[model samples]
Target chain A: MSDFTRDEIHRLALLARLEFTDEQADAFAQQLTQILHYVETLNGLDTTGVEPTSHALALHSVMRDDEPRPSLSNAEALANAPEQEAGCFRVPPIIQEL
Target chain B: MTDAPAYATLKELQRSLEAGECSSRELTQALLDRIEALDGKLGAFLRVTPDEALQQADAADAARRQGRRSPLLGIPLGLKDILCTRGVATTCASRILRDFIPPYDATAVARLRQAGAVFLGKLNMDEFAMGSSCEFSAWQPTRNPWDPTRIPGGSSGGSAAAVAAGFCPATLGTDTGGSIRQPAALCGVVGLKPTYGRVSRYGLIAFASSLDQIGPFARTVEDCALLLNAIAAQDPLDSTSAPVATSDYTECLGREIRGLRVGLPREYFIDGMEPAVEAAVRRAVADLAAQGAEIVEISLPHTEYAVAVYYICATAEASSNLARYDGAHYGYRAAGTRNIIEMYSRSRTEGFGEEVKRRIMLGTYVLSAGFYDAYYSKALKVRTLITRDFAEAFRQVDVIATPTTPGVAFRIGEKLDDPLQMYLSDIFTISANLAGIPGLSLPCGFTAEGLPIGLQLLAPAFEEARLLQVAHAYEQSHDWWRRRPELA
Candidate 1:
């Protein structure tokens, strides 16, 4: 079984974008190990020649015609925006000067 | 003239409305009154639009007077806040969208309204439907009606609790992993996650597009079937919705289960399962067998991988879907950001919960350039195997039966310290989502501690009619639904 080390756990948390305490990291490492152990049982199954199914029901070409249809107007769309200006959603600048 | 019509199912309420025994306005007011009395403790509703509900109800009553009758006419139910309700708050139990009222109704919500179903309000859920327990909601956690100190299983926790508490006849809930079934199991209600594509998801806030399915939580299997009839149809708005023919789910109720094959997967009866829960499941199976249903042991060997595979696949999809949540769109925005990129980062950081953020990160990692094949692709391969496991098992038996949850409801905060432990609560239910099969959880027995236990029955995709029939048959043979939570 692959052991999830503190570094690996930290990497996962980082990827998840969660700022976790050291204690939480350690705790999660132990917990994730147990979960992984249970999940590892999947290794025993032989999936030879089995077609990998993406959805339960098979669907082919699930697309609609490219006809322009009536949709919520921009006014209705931006009406719920917490901040809006010039018919577009307004947000603070992303680049930090600090 | 009688008091509140508590314990009435949706069909019963509809009959009353059509017979003019009660009007939609009266029923809506009754539900609002119940919510006012019980929601102080249950915390099920995220928003209560009494005036809007009454207005719709009055219109429904007028329609019935004109001889227009839909099965759900005038029935009051809650929409999971995750479903967009036009001109109504659909916060999805997250701070990011707390103040956002959608300008468009979800296809499911719009259809429910067209069916003459009255909306009681939007129910609470795990923030972005990420958590197993309702504890992740930005709002207060919804309490289990059976025991206020315990959690109402989530991310459909509020939907389950509201039905269990009789605040509404039924409620709509979206299930990605085990959100619908787990909570329904824990809350002792009938919760069914129909085969994927059975219902449309045009306006449901996307979690995992492929895995997410909207279904019903009700007090009985019959009620669930009725709700499904009203909601399950091929929707032009939802490209992924099934184009198959729909069935009237209640038609097979009370039918003989005699000589029916029921498979008990050995993989599901693993170690660490609570003995009481196992006993309850066995007892229910024995009862079915005594009723002439054939009980056979089967193996879904790949079932063990569901949680890992689900986490990988669902998170990957969520990471992609939620990428659109940048402040440029509706939802929360961070102040003092210098550019669009930083705005997206800060807004997401502040908008999502710890669990959601964790999954998003995991999703990002798995979908990242280097790890996509190793994690995401491999998970999809394993998911295919999981579905095949059910497929092969179903060939041996008509339906698969198991304990809905590994154990009865755990006390709130019991596993909050260990997120992994909390994740395991969905272990038994996740495989169903992985396979995109129709699965139902209904009250079967009670633990020695007096808490309810549920039995899960699963069928191949698009077999909701059979699944509901099996559940309804069992419900008829048992009196578990007659018991109510001792909450005052």
Candidate 2:
């Protein structure tokens, strides 16, 4: 039996910073429960003492000399901004007045 | 379109250009006209750039006039929309970045440009490369050229469809988990997903960073090799780019495969696969065997766990990569929001499609405080086991062969409502990405209904030369590469 629930779905959406309608959330909850049920098959395998492989290559932290180079100008970087003011991206206010 | 030669391979196109039979401008113009006439029903291209293409074609012609000849010079190609192109709208078929215009070309795109390949325009894909069928695209879904009622397997559906429809000689595609191979299989074209880090990924829009790699789709094994030769190079811009040297992949086209050993994994030839698909792939392997190639039965024991492992790892990376789209940066922003949090949440909810949201939420759940070790960490350990399976199998065989998909192309809406079934579409192709090996898909045979079946050839990591050699041998011995979809 799957442990997924509607409350857990809502909690996940909140953590993901997504807003879903009640109807959408209901549908998603059902679908996700089914998918989770299918993926639970992985738990059947015995994988003791196995080292996790996060990347295909074995390269460590790659670094270059600390030097300035040409990059996108402010105008080019902000070219696709939905809203901009004073060469900066503009967003809704983070704080609210009481 | 009448002036365009009917040569099916990019190598033939190169020969024609070198011989001055037709100028690059003429070939580019005819293809542009064909796209204008046929693309409405196919829905392959989201945008077409005639002016830029003509300008590049003219320059290629001028370069040829100076007696310089290169394999990809003066060839017109389509780019999957996920690859950023300067001054072109590089939407990954998502409404969120529908208006986003990149300021620079992706490393692979820049390499193709330097190699003198003319760009037609941006192609469509599944939203954020998240779906198996192209139906999740914000634009109209790309229909298979072989049958308009069926899907061209995605998220590289548009790339495969455009090439199959003859809109261009070839195109670039990205595959994380069978996006390139599955679509190419369904559309009856050739697709190659090189070893991870074989091609640079600097400007490709992030989906699953660890799994995504750019590749090519073309009509013939040789054309795929030509395109791979141009774009497979190391770039400092991409930290994950492999430092290994690039080789002329075309040079191995006619290599003898008489002494080669091919492996057939017992796990892949199990029940539930379509009868016709299995028969076609078996016949192809038999054809190679008759040519003196040896076949060995092998076991990739952890194959059953690929889907679970892929979804966990891909979604986890996707959730982290996509956190940058918070409505404050470039892309869509929700209007009439009272606070920043509301702005971010509402914008994403309205901007992303259903599939993207599902994966995002699933990723969040797995990586949550209590579930990390149970889900994400466990998946990583299982992933190592899967990789080891491939390593052990490669020791006994030079290449592994399997059916690219379990069956032929399903109808457009066949699996839309079932996410689990859709993920299963990539069952045969995901292990390559997980193990970071190279894989190729080309037409082996077709069903009685005329839909194509693909035979996949996978090689050890960085052994693309061996993979292409075997594929080219099989392709030359068969007539499947000569057939094209009769699009009206």
- TM-score leader: 2
Q: B41-135 in candidate 2: lDDT tens per residue?
A: 99999999999999999999999999878788889999999999999899899999989999999999999999999999989899999988899
Q: What is the C-alpha lDDT of each candidate?
A: 0.85, 0.91
TM-scores of the candidates are 0.94, 0.99
True contacts recovered per prediction? 0.53, 0.81
Candidate 1 chain B least-lDDT 10 residues: B1-10
Model 1, C-alpha of B19: deviation from truth (Å)? 2.3
i-RMS for every candidate: 2.8, 0.8
Judging by lDDT against the true structure, name the best candidate.
2
TM-score of 2: 0.99
lDDT of 1 by residue, B1-488 (tens): 22357678877887787678888898788878888887898898988999899999989888888889788888888989999998898899998897888888898899888888889898989999998889999988999999999999999999999988888889999999889999999999999999999999899999999899999999998899888888899988888998889988889888888989999999889899989899989988998898899999999987768888887788889988887777677888878777766677678778877777666766776687776766677777898888878889989999999999998888999988676678778889999988889999999988777788989999988989888878887888889997888767
Candidate 2, residues A11-56: lDDT per residue as tens digits?
Answer: 7898999977777778888998888888778889888999998887
In model 2, state the lDDT of residue B429.
Answer: 96
- lDDT value, residue A39 of candidate 1: 47
